[model samples]
Target chain A: MIEVKKLRKSFDGRTVLHDIDATFYTGKTNLIIGQSGSGKTVLVKSLVGLLRPDKGEILFDGRNLLTMTSQEVKELRKEIGMLFQGSALFDSETVLGNVMFPLTMFTSMSRAEMLDRAMFCIERVNLKGAENKYPSEISGGMQKRVAIARAIALNPKYLFCDEPNSGLDPKTSIVIDELLSDITHEYGITTVINTHDMNSVLGIGENIIFINKGHREWVGDMSQIYTTSNEALNDFVFATRLFQDVRAYVAKHGKI
Target chain B: MILTNSLANFGRYCMFLTRTFSIPDRWSVFGKRTIQEVSKLGIDSIPLVIIISLFIGAVCTIQMQLNVSSPLIPSYSVGLATREIILLEFSNSILCLILAGKVGSNIASEIGTMRVTEQIDALEIMGVNSANYLTLPKIVAFVFFMPVLSVLCMGTAFIGGWCVAAFTDIIPVSRYVYGLQTMFTEWYVWYGLIKSLVFAFLIASISSYCGYYVKGGALQVGKASTDAVVSSSIFILLFDVILTKLLLQ
Candidate 1:
């Protein structure tokens, strides 16, 4: 579990995250949802140590991230895995090589052992035959799966994905979402996803934090999301006609 | 304002070098990457080096022959001039200037594309020292391969000059070879090799730095590639002057 306390960040005096506090539980898919420019990306970047927050206590299972030395941070990062929005697979490496990279970097396993583990990850992600293919050889969905396979290759204690469903079709998005959810539950990893995809939010968001203009406006699960009383959250969740219809049906049926 | 910005960038670059020069987390990986970089940035560059040196050597011979067309000047002066030009300057400094366009821009564009695409971020999050992992191999490979390239360039240019002598009525090939052998200070070759090593490091590091800190999208990556080539060329020329003065004196 990761706990953030009073996280404040700004850019050139423009506050982006204003004294935010949140908790991500283990074995759950925690989603950070907000519109574009709502500071969700900044929050995720800060959490992953890509960006330093101005003031905050980022506690990864009680260890303070801000106070840790650079060496310690690097050591701690071994237990952390991230899937970038663009998948970010090394263009030069094949899917198998990509999956084997973290193991190759951090493990004492021999080549055959590493290959076996990488093959296991590839099989787990349902990308058995695509191992020899480059990232460019695969579709976006397959690339994301490859990214996921690589992310979980280490069986990390924490998993962070930045907009994991962006640029993917609806069907592919659901597959990626279910994969993330299943992996989170399977490994009991503290999985945090930064996304605005409604299907993802309603489908797999076990613990959701809705940020509005750099402020946390609402915090709840998908079940409570449809019946939330927050006006800003309502504006965001029902912005589309399909969601509005869902909201209406939820109101009439008293549940979704 | 410009001065302040430049100072800031210099500080940032120093910090970047600090990160890049750190001990690799895995030596085996580093070795593999260094070999890969050598092939990509060094061996692949051989044909271009050969072709350019050949043409430049021929041109140097022809130009020397045309200009030294006087009875007072010895017939061997054309060969001597071509040898001196190729050995003292063209093989090392001029060759690096040309490579700043091909290899420097390549390093810049590749790293810049990785930056814009979040590949570097991915490395960082995986606890890899992205700078060290990415840039060190390129720097080490280029620096080590540079002296070999200088020697090859010198030999190829000599062949080109010999070809000019053999084909055109500039000078006899025997005389040209004699002139190349005459007063050939082995130190001049060492001097060129040393200069090439420094220039190679500059090109690789500066280009990697430009690419590593790239912001925005594909356009910014292109701009970084241009900046890398331009900056590397400028530095190579500047260092050539400094090294020439220091080494020759």
Candidate 2:
């Protein structure tokens, strides 16, 4: 579990995150949802040590991330895995090579052992025969799956995905979402996803935090999302007629 | 303001080099990458080196023959002058300036594209020292192969001059070979090789630095590549003068 306390970040005196406090539980999918320009990206970047917050305590299972030394940070990063929005696979490496990279860099595994582990990851992501193909040879959905496979190759304690569903079709987005949810539950990894995809929010948003203009507007699970009294989140999440009718039906039937 | 910014950039460049010289996390990976880079940056440049050296060598011979044809000037002076020009300047400094355009821009654009596409971020998130992992092998490969390239450039240039003498009425091949052999201070070759090594390091590191810190998107990457070439060329010329004064004096 990761605990954030009074996280404040600013750039050139313009505050991006204003004294934010949140907890991301282990073995759960923690979704940070907001419109564009919200501080969700900044928050995630700070959590992963990509950006430093001006003032706050980011404790990863009781260890303060800010106070850690450079070496400590590096040691901690080996236990963390991230899936970039663009599925930032090395353009030069094939799928098998990409999955084997972290193992090669971090572990003492022999070549055959690394290959076996990478093959297992590929199989887990359902990309069995595509190991020899380059990232450019695959579709965006496949690339995301490759990224997911690469992310889990090390079986990290924490997993961060930055807009994992962006640029993917609805069907592919659901697949990616379900995969993330399954992985989080299976490995007991503290999985945090930054996304504005409402389908993701309503589908597998086990613990959702809605941010509005650099502030946490609401916090709830899917069960309580429609019954929330937050106007901003309602306007943003249930803006479409389809969602509004669903909200009406949920209100009338008291069901999801 | 401009001076302050320049100072800051220089400081940042120093810091970047410091980070880039760390011990590799895995020696096997380093070995593999260095070999790959030697092929990419060094072996691939052989054709360009041969072509340029040949043309310059032939031009020097022709120009020296035309200008030094007077009775007061010995017949061997054309060969001597061409040899001096190729050995002292063209093979080392000029070649590096040319490569500062080719290899330097290539490194800049490739790394800059990686930066814009978040590949570097991905590497960093995986706890890899992205700077060292990406830039060190290129620097090592270029610096290590520079002496070989210099020797090859010198040999190919002499061959070019030999071709000119054998085919044309500019000068006799025997005289040119004799002039090349005459008063050939082996230290000059060493000096050129040393200078080439420094220039190669400059080209690789400066280009990598330009690319590594690239922000924004495609336009910024294009600008960084241009900046890498221009900056490396300028530094190569500057170092050529400094090294010549220091080494020759």
In model 2, what lDDT does residue A200 have?
96
Instruction: Give the candidate number with the greatest DockQ.
Output: 1
Candidate 2 docks with a DockQ of 0.85
The per-model lDDT (C-alpha) reads: 0.96, 0.94
Clash pairs, model 2 backbone: none
- Model 1 RMSD to the real structure? 1.5
lDDT string for model 1 (B13-101, tens) is 99999999999999999999999999999999999999999999999998998999999998888888888899899999999999999
Question: How well does chain A score by TM in each candidate?
Answer: 0.96, 0.95
Model 1, range A1-256, lDDT digits (tens) per residue? 9999999999999999999999999999999999999999999999999999999899999999999999999998999999999999999999999999999999999999999999999999899999999999999999999999999998899999999999999999999999999999999999999999999999999999999999999999999997889999989988989878887998899988
Clashing pairs in 1: none
Give the C-alpha miss distance for residue B177 in model 2, angstroms.
Answer: 1.2
| Stretches of model 1 off by over 4 angstroms after superposition | A245-256
lDDT per residue as tens, model 2, A1-256? 9999999999999999989889999999999999999999999999999999999999999999999999999999999999998999999999999999999999999899999999999999999999999999999999999999999999999999999999999999999999999999999999999999999999999999999999988899989987789999988888878989987998899987
